[model samples]
Target: MEFDYIIIGAGSAGCVLANRLSADPHISVCLLEAGPEDTSPLIHTPVGVAAILPTRHVNWAFNTTEQRGLNNKLGYQPRGKTLGGSSSINGMIYIRGHRTDYDDWKALGNTEWGYEEVLPYFRKSESYYGGTNQYHGTEGELFVSRLQLHGVTKDFIEAGISAGHSHNADFNGEEQEGVGAYDVTIHKGKRWSTASAFLKPIREQRSNLKVITGALAERIILDGKKAVGVSIRQKGKSRQLKARKEVLLSAGAFGSPHLLMLSGIGPAEELAPQGIAVLHELPGVGQHLQDHPDVVISYRSPDTSLLGVSVSGSAKIGATLWQYLRHKTGSYASNCAEGGAFLKTDPNLDRPDIQLHSVIALLDDHNRKLHWGHGFSCHICVLRPKSVGSVGLTSSDPAVAPKIDPNLLGQEEDLQTLLKGYRMALEIIKQAPMAKYQLQDIYSADALTDEQLSEVIRARADSIYHPVGTCKMGRDENAVVDSHLKVHGIDNLRVVDASVMPTLVGGNTNAGTIMIAERAAEWIMQDQATA
Candidate 1:
C-alpha cells in the first residue's frame, strides 16, 4: 500500500516525524520500528538505564571488532531498538551542545543549519521546566528539568567549583563551560523520552499515522534512481510498502547509512568488491564516523558512594524500594551521571577540548564488566575529537552488524588531550570542599607518571556514547546527503537523523538529534505544501 510518507526506524527523529507529519489529517504516514514496543518498566525510570544496558529487549548491543587504538579491546556500542530508539535507554542529560557546534555546520556548506536558524527548532521541541526564555521554550513536548542531586552528588558539584571551575547551573542556558549538575530529559523524577513526550499524546489522535513495531527494514526499494518504498521483514515474511510522496530515513547514525548502502547507493569501488551491484555510486553514504572518547579517573570515597550503595546489600535495596514507594525519590530516581563539566584541556584550544561526566559510582570498561568497590569516579571525554572513523559492511547479509571502526586515539594530540583531562580531574578531587570526603585515588594516580598516564589514556578510553556523521550532510564530493538532508542523487528521499550531522556535537547528541528531526519535519511539510 502507498502512503503520503513512510518513515523508517521509529527512533527519536522518526517519532517526531510521525507526530508532525501526521498532523495534517489529509496526509497518511507509516512509522516502522525494528524492535518491539517500549513497555519495559525500566524505560520510564530515569535511573533504570543501567539495568537495561546488557539486555537486548530495547537495546542493540553492538560491539566493535578489537580496536587497535585501545590495545585491541573490543568496545561495546549500544543503540536503542525500541520506538524511541536510544532515547528509550540513555543517560538522560539534556544537553544541546555549544552554539559554535551548530555554527560550524553552517560553515560546512549547510547554510540552513546555522545556530541562529536551528535555535528555534531546538526550542520548538523542548518543554523546559526551567521556564521559557530566549534560550528555552516551555510549551514543547519533550521534558527538560532541573536535576535532583543527592548529598554525595552535591559534594561532587562543589568539588568541581572549589577546583577553580565556576558553577553554571544550566548547560543549555547562557554558557556551557564550567562544572555543575546537569538538566535531564526527566519530569518530576520520571523519564520523558520521545515516546512519552511526542508519541503518547498523539498516537490515538492521529489515525493517519500507522506505527509498526518489530518490522525490520531490509533495504530501500528503488524505482530507477529514486527511493520508491521500503522492503521490510515482519513476522518472518517480507513485505513491501510504498511511499507515494517520500521515503524518509530517520534510522540514526548506524542504521540510515547501512540501509543506504544495502539498497546499492553507496561508493562503487567499495560495493563492487562485495559483489553488490551499485545502483548509484554515492561515495559518502557510510563514511565520516565520529564519537567522543571518555577516560575514567577513579577515587575511593570516605563513605559508601551512590555507586557503592546501589550494588551493596539487601538493606540498601529495601531502603531504595521503600523510598520509591513513599515519594518516587531515592537512589533509584537518580541517573548515575549526576554532574558534568565542559572544559578546555588546553587553555590555547579554540573551545573546550574535553567534557567531564562525574558519576556517583565507579565504573570500568564502560560499566559492562569490572566495576570498582565503594568508590566514586569521573569520566573525562575528549569533545570535538581530532580522530576520524568509518562504518562499512562486514558481509553481504543485511542481518550482520556493520564493521564500526571509530579509529579512536589515532592522533597523538587526542592522547595528550585525554591525559590533560585526567590530570584536571585529579586536581578537582584534591580541592578543599571535595577533599572533605577524603577521596583516595583508587586508580593509583601516583603509580603512573605523566608519560605513563598518556599510555593509560589511550588504552582505556571509550566512547562517551555520542556517535554521528556516518551519513554526513554537505555539498562536497564525499557528501552523502545535501543541506536539506535529501540524498544528493536520489529524489523524494531524506536522511533526517544524527546521520545528517557533518560532525558530532560538542556534548550529548540527543538534543541535537531531536532538533535535527524537528527542523527536518518542517522542511518536509513545507516541501509537501509547495508540491
Candidate 2:
C-alpha cells in the first residue's frame, strides 16, 4: 500500500508526527516501528521501569565503545524499542531544557528555532497539571503531573534549600537554575507514553493511519537522492513500502544516522568500510554526537521508604502491587528518579551546566547489577558537555547494530564539571534533613583529593540516556538537516528526532523532541497546502 507519508521509528517524535499528519483523514500515514507494539502491561505501570530497563524485552540496550576516558569501561545505552519509544520505558521526567539551548540553535544558523518560536509548540503538546499558564498548556495530547513525593524526596529538597539553593516548585517554570521536584509524564499513576497520548487513542478511528509492528526499516529507497520508499524486514521476510509524497525519518539519534549510513547517505569513509555504495554523501550524517555524561554518589541507608527487596520489603511490594492494581497508587507508581535539581556550577553562567537526580533506590550500572540492603543514590550529570562522539556503521548488514563511540569524557572540562557536581551532592547529603537517615558513603571516602575523585568519576561515569546530534540541524556544512528538518542533500525526506538536535539541551530530550515533532507537523501540513 502506498502512503502519502512513511514515518520510520514510532518514538517520541514519530508518534506525534503520526497523530498530527494523519488527523487530516485524507492523508495516508504509515508508521513503521522496528520493535513490537506497546502491549506489555509493564509498560503502562510507572514502576515497570525496573522491569523494562535491565532487559532487551522492550529496550535496544545498546552499549558504547570502551572509553579510554573511563578506564576502558564500556557504557550502557538503553533505548526503548516499543511503540512509545524511549518515552515508554524512560524515567518519565518532563524537561524541555533551558531556553538558551534553543537560542543557541538559532544562533548557529537555524531559523525559526529560537526559544520564543519553539515555546508555542512545547505549550501546544502539553497537558500541564497546574492547568493553563503562560509556560504550560492544559488541554493537549501529553499529560504532565507532579511526582508522588516520598519523605526522602522531601528531605532531599529541604536539604537543597539548606545548601543555599532556591526552592523551585516547578522546574519547567520561569527559572531553571534551582532545586525542585520534576514534573513527569504520568497520568493517574501510569506512564503517559507518546503512544498512549497520541497514537493509541486515534489508531482505530483513523482509517488513513497504519501502524506496523515488528518491522525493521533497513534502508530508504533513494531514487537519485529522493527518498521514495523504505525496504523493511519483518518475520524473516522482506517487503517494500512506498511513500508517495515524503518520507519522515524519526528513527532517533543512533538509528537515524545508522539508517542514513546504510542507505549510502553518510560519510564515504564510513560506507567504504561497510562495502555499501555511496548514494548521497553527507559527511555530517553520524558526527557531532552529544550526551549527558554522569556519575553517582551512593549512600547505604536503612531507609525502608525507598524500593528494596528484603523479606519485609518483598512483602511490602506484594501489598503495593495489589494497591496499584486496584487504585494505581503505591510504591509501585514511582518512576524511581522522582526528585531532581538543575543548578549552575558557576554563578555567572547563563544556564545550568549540571543536573542532579535523586533516585529512591540504589540505581547503579543502569541497575544491571543488584545490591543487597536498602540505600539511596544521587546522580550528577554534566549537561551540555563539550565532549562529542560519533555513530558509525560496523557492517554492511542492516540488522547489525551501529558502532556507538560516545568518546565519553573526551573533554577535561566535562570531567571537571562532574567533579564539582559530585562534591555538591556530597554536601547535600550532609545536610540536616537527610543526615539522620544517612549511614555511610557507600561509593567513596570523605575529603578525597582531586586525583581520587577523578578516578572515581571515570570508573562510574555513564550515559544518562540523552544521546543526540548525529544528524544535527543547522545551516553549516557539517549539518545533516536544514532549519526545517529536511536532509541537506536529499529530497522528499526529513529527519524528525533527537538526532537533529544541533546541541545537547540542558535537561532531558523527551519534551524537546516532542516539541520538535509538534512543530514539524505544522511545517509538513503547511508544505502540503503550498504543494
Candidate 3:
C-alpha cells in the first residue's frame, strides 16, 4: 500500500500531523502506533497516571545503565506507548517553557524556530479555556485549563501564598516566575489526551487518514539513499508500505533514532561494530540526549493528605464513591502534579532554571507501595541540564531496547544548579504559610548539613519525565535534521518530535513537542504547494 505521507508514531506529534496533513482531502496519510489504543480507564482518569507508571500496559519502563557520577545507580525512564504517546500517560502539566528556550534555537541558525515565530503554532493547537491572546490560542484542538475542582490543590495554593513567592494566576500568563497550581490538559475533570483532543474528534470525517495500532515499524525501507517507506511487523506478519511524498518519523526520542540507524542512517563506526550496515554514515543520528532529573523532598504532613485518603481501607473507598456520586470529582480526577513553579536557581542565571512539582502524596521510589499516610513531597528539577548523552542501537533486532545514556549530572554546573534548587525548596517549606501546615522534614533529617544534602541530591535524583534531543535539528554539520525538520542526508524524510530539540526546554516537553509537529505540518503542506 502507498500513502502520500506515512507518520511512524501516532503520538502527540503524529496526531497533529495526521490531522493537518489529511485536512487536504486529496492527500492520503497513514499513522502507525506500536502501542495499543488509548482506551485505558487509568489514562483518562487524570490521577490514574500514578497507577499506570509501573505497568508495562501503557508505559515502556526502560532503565538506563548505571551512571558513574551518581554512585553507579541506574535511573528509571518511562515512555508512553499508547496512541497519544506520553501526552496520554504523563502528569498532564501544560508548560511551554521559557521564551528564550525557543530563541536559543534561532541563535543556533534555525531561523523559522524563534519563540515569536513558533508562539502562533503553539496557540493554534491549544484550545485554551481562558480566552485567546498574543501567546495563547482559544479555538485550537488541544485542551488547556485551570483545575475545575480540587481540595488539596487549593490548600497548596494558600501555602504558596504564605511562602512569600508571588502567587501567579496563570503559569502561562504574563509572568512565569511565581508559585501557582498548574493548568492541565483536562476537560470537565477528565484527562484530555492528544488522541482525545485532536485525533479522536476528527477520525471519522477524515477518511483519508488511516490509523494502524499495534503495528511496530521495524525500519524505513530505503530506495537507494531516500526513505521510500517503512517495513512494519504486526500479528507475526511483515508488511511493506510505501510513502509517495515522505516518510515522516514521529517515533519520538527512543524510536525515531533507532529507526534511522536501522534504515542505515547513523554513525558508521557504531553500526559496523553492531553488525548493522551503515547507509548514510551520518555520525549525529543520536548524539545529543537530554532529560531533567529531579529529586523528591518529602515531609510528614500534620493534616490529612490526599495520599492518606486514597489509601485508607473502607473509609477511603467510601469517600471516593461519595465524591464521584456528588460532582464527578474526587482524587481520581487529579493529575497528581497539581502545584508547580518555574523559578530561578540563582540571580546570575539568565532565565528561571528550576521547576517544582508539589504532589499531595507519598512517593517513595516511584510510588511503589500500598502504604498510605498524610505526606507531601516537592520534586525539584534543574530546568536547563548541562549534561548531554546519546541513544544508540543495541543490535539489528527490532525487539531490543535502544541503549539510552543521559549521562546525568556530568557537569559541575548541573550539580550546583540542582543543589541550589534543593536549597530553595527547603526555604519555601520553612516560610510562614507552608510552615503553618506543619511540614516535617522526613527524607534526610540525618543529613542536615549542606554537604550532606549534596550527597542526598546525588543519591536520589530521578527524571522529572522530560526527555528530548536525541536527533537534534540545527544548521551545524553534526545536526541530524535541518531547520525545517527534514533529515540532513535524505530527501522526503523528516523527524517531527521531541527527538529534534536542539536543547531541552525549561519545562515540560509535551507542549513544545506538539507545537513542533503543528509547525512541521504547516511546513510540509506549504512546501507541497510551492513544489
Best by TM-score: 2
lDDT of 1 by residue, 1-531 (tens): 789899998888899999999999999999999999899889988778877776676898888767777888887788999989999999988888898889899999899888899999999998888789999998899988876787667877788888888898888877888898888888767888898888889998888999999998888999998889999989989999999999999988888888888889898766776778899889888889998888887766646535564345447768876886688787677788888889987678676778888777666666665444556778888888888888888776667787888878777777888888888888877777676666676555664698788767766787877889988999998898889889998898899899889987889999999999999888899998999
TM-score of 2: 0.99
Candidate 2 residue runs with Cα over 4 Å from true position: none
Write out the backbone clash pairs for model 2: none
lDDT of 3 by residue, 1-531 (tens): 999999999888999999999999999999999999999988888878888886676888888878765767887787889889988888998998888888999999999999889898889998898888777898898889877534555666666667667788776656778788888898877888889988998889988999999899988998887889999999979999999999999989988998888888999876887788877888888889999978898777656645553344448757775785576577777777788777887667777889988887767667654444576778999888989888887888787888888888878788888888888777776665565557767667678787898788888887777889988998777799999999997988999999999999988899999999999999999988888
List candidate 3 segments past 4 Å from native. Answer: 148-152, 309-314, 435-437
TM-score winner between 2 and 3, please give it: 2
Model 1 gets an lDDT of: 0.84
Q: What value of lDDT does candidate 3 attain over all alpha carbons? A: 0.84
- Residue 310 accuracy (lDDT) in model 2: 78
lDDT of 1 at 286: 80
